[model samples]
Target chain A: MSAVVITVTSGKGGVGKTTATANISTALAAMGKKVVAIDADIGLRNLDVVMGLENRIVYNLVDVVEGTCRLRQAMIKDKYLPELYLIPAAQSRDKTALTPGDMIELTNQMREDFDYILIDSPAGIEQGFKNAIAPADRVLIVTTPEVSAVRDADRIIGLIEAEGKYSSDLVVNRVRVDLVRRGDMLSTEDVVDVLAISLIGVVPDDESIIISTNQGRPAVLQNGSLAGQAFRDIAARLTGQTVPFMELDGHDSFMKRLSKLFKL
Target chain B: MPNDRIKIKGTSNGLVITLGAGAWPRLVEELDALLGERASFFKGGRVALRVGARLLSTADIEAVGQVLSKHHVTLWAVESEAEETRTAAAELGLEVELEPRPISPEQSRPTAGDTILIRRTLRSGQVVEFPGNVVVIGDVNPGAEIRAGGNVVVWGRLRGAVHAGMNEELGEMAVVCALDMSPSHLRIGDYLALSPADDSRTQIVPEMAFVHDRQIVAEPWSV
Candidate 1:
């Protein structure tokens, strides 16, 4: 089956692009799809660690691109899911070691074997980011609710549109419901209004995500985690499933709930 | 010196680099050397190359563009007297003439009639500048900017910075109007004003801004 290459990027750093890539790849694989995750952040490679495939990486994306190893040899199979694989980045090399042409060729060769190829793009609008999106069929931009993050996301959306490749979807991460309720943080509607893109997912700020990430197990594997559910829903939406967004305000005051009920 | 063959001057739109009369190879080499010498000053700057009466081919224009781009400068327009050069520049998506055409001696008097129309949203980091009035049919998000020599009008939301009557010689007669006026910064000639801090949550309504008593003021659009 042909694979749909999707690139996950954010102009600002520490916006959970790597986490989204790892969890979304896991969630898609759990759905019985053959998924291949590529870490396009060469010098700061962390997708392999997040995916729990760090120690198993014998070869990397640079190796495959440089012809030192075959594409199959560089792919590290997931310990839990038999259908999931990850092509880790070369920690010793930088972005210049791989070009956009190399990424396009690599994804094309693997298109016949996988159902979805998810690329975790590095932060910034540099060569690494270009390489990640070179072969993308769709783009997912992750950003926090902060003004700086939203502004960067807006710039990234403009850049992606200028490329004329694929339409991008937005995933607002690290959203604290209490802060939003207090009017101290930007809501999903505010971010969407500024970026003017379709909202694909809204991941709440959950402590379980940090714990699960440290354990080398993505939060999506945890059934009770809210962020995990968001990722799962995002994957479903990616597969053309229309899953309604989950209500993040679980601790809404009675007056607020009454107001909402009365308005309806 | 060979560097004297290339002259760079700052204009209202951007830098205008004039290539002196010489062979194409010599002119190109001198231009590259001049850019390399002042790379830091020219970094992230837009430029228009003026090649007087030269019949430059597409490849020649492209070569000049490549050199400028390497120095972190954008070649947005090409001003040339030759038809062939203008056609080559247009083929490469560069403007054939500099923007905000210079007023002739007979038409030196400033008028607020000429305007440029834009039909799309101006996202963050986008800038629209014109010599005459500007009318936008879409939203201007935060961080986007619009600078005009005369009045400015937005049929949609205008939440970005806008400078109307950029040419101070035209006096403070320019006005700015928008369906939802909440600009980060508003300017009329030399006067500048910021949106009130508490106006963010206010309901959207049609408004007009202009210079009143040497200060920028905004009022509900009536006429």
Candidate 2:
């Protein structure tokens, strides 16, 4: 089956684009679908480390484009999921090393072999951003519930529309159910109303996500974490399933509620 | 193909056509030939033709005016340091006054009273202004703004800032409603309302906001 290239991007940094690419790729592959995750942040490579495949980098995306290696040689298989692979970005080189044409061509070739291609886009609306979206069949914007993040997401959505490309969606990451319940944070409705785009997934703020990231195991691997379920639901939706968003209303921590009560 | 024509520049006030040197009959003939070639471009256009000291009788000015009229163009005024051309233009009922300066906004702010509808959400950092009603079918994100002289309507949530009836008092109302109503600030006339905490577990339904007792108050949208 041909791959569907989806770019995960956020205009603001540290909004978890790389983590999303890793987790979504792993989850889709776990479902017996062949997936390839491409780290489009050429200079600042982090997807490899997050996916626990940092040590096995012989050929990178630059090598594949520059004819130093075949496309197959550059794809590093995942540690646990054999159906998943990652085409790591070049750590030593900068974003200018690869052109948008290179990215488009690489993704086109990979599409013939894999069922899904997830691109981890770098932050900002620069050359890196262009390279990431140049080959995408769909774009998933990741943003938190904060005002600043939503603001940046708005700007990115405008730019995407300006480029004459349509069919883009939004995913609100790291939502706190407790804060939302207490009216201290923006809820899913708040973000959707502001962004005015179709919502695909809403991931809750689970501390287990941080622990999983540090250990090079994406939270999606746990199969029980609420955030992991969210990612899986997102993958299912991407595959044309009508999975509803995983509800996080019952998981609000007692301490979180207590802090809200004391603050008010 | 006739290069014997005067060149014209368009300004807000009128057109300025610079005359070329030639025999009187030849010049008139050339002007006629030139206007004929591009009649559509100059149709219904008002012109101030500049002829530099070319001696002309009333007949010459009449001939030029006739040629201009044939192309549906009006000769508004004549520009020249030449005394004779000015006298001829004044004799032909055309104004001899200097070209008028462009009217600035200080001279006019005539409201057309036209309104523009924005069908998409006004996201953060997006600003829109209208002299009349501003209707938005989507959300107005925080840090975004909508300034209108008449009224404002938001079909979705409005968590951003908005100002209505900017030039007047609370006469012009600002209404913002969404499935979830939360705004950084909402202003109508002189009244402003800072957003309160959102209510979760409450299925957000459509709501409408308006100025109440010099403050912004929201009510559930009903028929």
Candidate 1 lDDT by residue in tens digits, B1-223: 4545578888887799987643465467768888888889999999998888655767888998898889999998889765446655765767777876564423532235566677666767767666678899888888889988888999998989999998767648899999999999998898899988987555777999988887888889775
- The CA lDDT of each predicted structure is 0.84, 0.78
lDDT of 2 by residue, B69-88 (tens): 99999887776554435544
Name model 2 segments beyond 4 Å from true.
Answer: A252-264, B1-114, B127-134, B145-223
User: In model 2, what lDDT does residue A176 have?
Assistant: 89
DockQ of 2: 0.10
Name the candidate that leads on TM-score: 1
**What is the per-residue lDDT of model 1 for residues A1-264, given as tens digits with 9 covering 90 to 100?**
899999999999999999999999999999999999999999899998888888998999999999999999999999889999999999999998987657877998999999999999999988898888768889999999999998888778766654444379999999999999999999999998878888999998888888988888988998767789899999999999999998887635533664676688
Give the alpha carbon lDDT tens digit for every residue of A195-244 in model 2: 88899999888887888888899888984577887898899999999996
DockQ, model 1, C-alpha based: 0.11
Give the candidate number with the greatest DockQ.
1
Q: Which sections of candidate 1 miss by over 4 Å?
A: A251-264, B1-116, B167-171, B196-201
